[model samples]
Target: MPYSRRAAVYDVEYTEERDVGFILGLVGQAAPSVLEVPCGAGRLSLRIAPYAGRLTVVDLEPEMVARTVAALEREGHGGRIRGRVADMRELRLEERFDLALIPREALQLLPPEEGRQALAAAAAHVAPGGRLAVDLATFLPVPGGAPDPDYYDPARTDGVWATDWIRTLSDGSQLVRQSAQHHDGMSIRFDLQYRVLQGGRVAEDWAAGMRLHRYSRGWIDDARPDGMAVEAVHGDYDGSDFTGDSPRLIALYRRGPAAGR
Candidate 1:
């Protein structure tokens, strides 16, 4: 799918609307010279603006970056927060941040190789003793974990009407909507269309595939940097310690003073 197309529904559908206090209390222990990667519409960045010493935000989608920039300007924080159109895997910045964050499973959006590149770029962006934090949704990567076929009612209580069953590919790497609402235990298939709008006009139509990968605990350990120290692995942004069944893995990495010298 086009990044802009996805960005249109980003704020409403894809965003994880967790409280700022929840994330701030954990990150605030360290000063907030923070860089937020894939900061869609600058939601979290704006939320933590008061505490932030310096905020550098980046998003791959131009529309998202533009919206965030405009919002910051309207909030009179344009000078305090910098919004850029950049990819996390190839981030380039003049100054290093005291802390960096990849929120709402933004890291998982990338394939494994690109995720590695993102980690390398993040390592370069943080100063020695600086921290890097990643927040993800905890979900078991079981078969048919993708969104089921359903209709989204803009004005409704449930908001979205998900289908009863979703078809799974043999390789477990792909999922496609087969049918619409069906009776309990009765399977159905469906094909749906989505439209992206700009200025209230249809701009594009996105057709792509999506799959979920519940990152194993081993995945976090493998991502550890050569010179960086693993500060903490938490279950969530609330700073609870990680356990074997912890769904979310918030890995805090710190580059040691000696190795980077």
Candidate 2:
């Protein structure tokens, strides 16, 4: 989960334009205190901070945290936003927040057990009756039951070429590869290989395996900690109802009255 190098070009690959509005709308008009876990490059944090009474963001990668802080400073929110480096599974924040978020499938990067633990840690930081929102990619099998071929294209910026592909293993796990080449002959590539575990052994391979988990409502239900109740599920940022064919799964949970008070 080291995002040091990826942090350089993350925003280029993943833009916030599509999600920012929906997320902000979900924050409501209450000016609630906020906590963001795995706030890589501050894509959402920077925008959300303005709407929050207070904002605290944490990421495991120091480089990402630094980038987030720098971005906030550039936007004149340095004093308003707090950025820190911390592990989600072992989070130890002293205070709770009215809203806690683990957006962009950040929790999916961890293995199953650790993912559950991370959810619990996030739940612990949510004040009673507060809400925790988590976004996950829908767990749908690739169409046609075959891996897609690699795609090559020129990067948005001049003088760069990029290629991307996925390999689906027989057991349903995936291996994804993204590579970029500069006109000057400099190149960098990364692979996210995932293997399905059955009885603690590799069952198969799948795409974007390292960063994405094939998540479902049952998965979240299984990971729910004590005193937490699933409140809503959305198919996308628009607050649409979740369905089997939805591309993303957004779950909202409320902390029980007696929990995390």
Candidate 3:
């Protein structure tokens, strides 16, 4: 139930689909087999399926897996992909993939140790000479960030999309508040509160505490799995080289000859 309960609300809340172009560029036109771990609601999976000869999507929450499966079926990709529930840390599959992706900075949601295991698990299924990629966020709070609590800042403004992240979900509820509870050097915990309105009246209230771990290029290099050589590392979705001041860490790797040794 980590993320399933929020499945429907989550599907509609975050409308933006991300990293498609950069990811697709890596997939190329080879029509190679691809694997996506924790495929969030199939938003990205649908686009990748056409380029993949065989697409396999997996998620830890059954609700997310179901939503992904339903989406693939709706989009006519059911025959090529199946979304299954499996923890990224413990996931074990016999097949190796031409490209394996961990999108949405998912590893951030896990503790450091678990995050490392997740990377290893994904690497284990990558075909030798194939590729592995992960996108993560480790931003330093915008220098002198929003002065007001109600201010919702845009992550990046390409002019195409810009909105406060907490604007209520139109389908049912609004995230009324998000407060930080605790933080160490490694992770931060948050208390999220929401209210669902019915006919302008309060219908339901939702609240939960969540934690997110942090990562950087060095963090990834230290935990790098065997045979996976760094191909490229970007600071943002625009594919710029990563630097110390970069807002995000997106790493791409290729499994070389030493794989599986």
In terms of lDDT, the best-performing candidate is: 3
Number of the candidate with higher lDDT, 2 or 3: 3
lDDT of 2 by residue, 1-261 (tens): 444755654544445456678778767735378899988888898789778878899998888889888988888887778887899999998988988999866776676678899999998998888888888765443354321111223323433434454444344544344443222222222234334455556655443313334556687788887788988888767788888876667888888889532
Q: What C-alpha lDDT values do all the predictions have? A: 0.63, 0.70, 0.73
lDDT tens digits by residue: candidate 1, 18-105:
5366668745878568888888877787777678878888988889988777877787777788888888999998878878888766
Q: Supply the global lDDT for candidate 1.
A: 0.63
Reference-based TM-score, model 3: 0.83
- Worst 10 contiguous positions by lDDT, candidate 2: 146-155
Residue 223 lDDT in model 1? 75
Best by TM-score: 3
Off by over 4 Å in 2: 29-31, 139-211
Segments of candidate 3 deviating more than 4 angstroms: 29-31, 141-182, 258-261
In Å, residue 146's CA in model 3 sits off its true spot by 11
Query: Could you tell me the lDDT of residue 150 within candidate 1?
Result: 17
Task: Give the per-residue lDDT of model 3 (tens digit) for 1-261.
Answer: 355667767665545545778778877835389999988777788788878878889987788888888877888878888666899999899888989999866788887778889999999998878888998876454355431112223243222222235446656455443443455567655555555655577776666556767786787788788878888888867889988866668888788977542
Model 1 lDDT at residue 232: 81
Q: Rank order by lDDT, top first?
A: 3, 2, 1
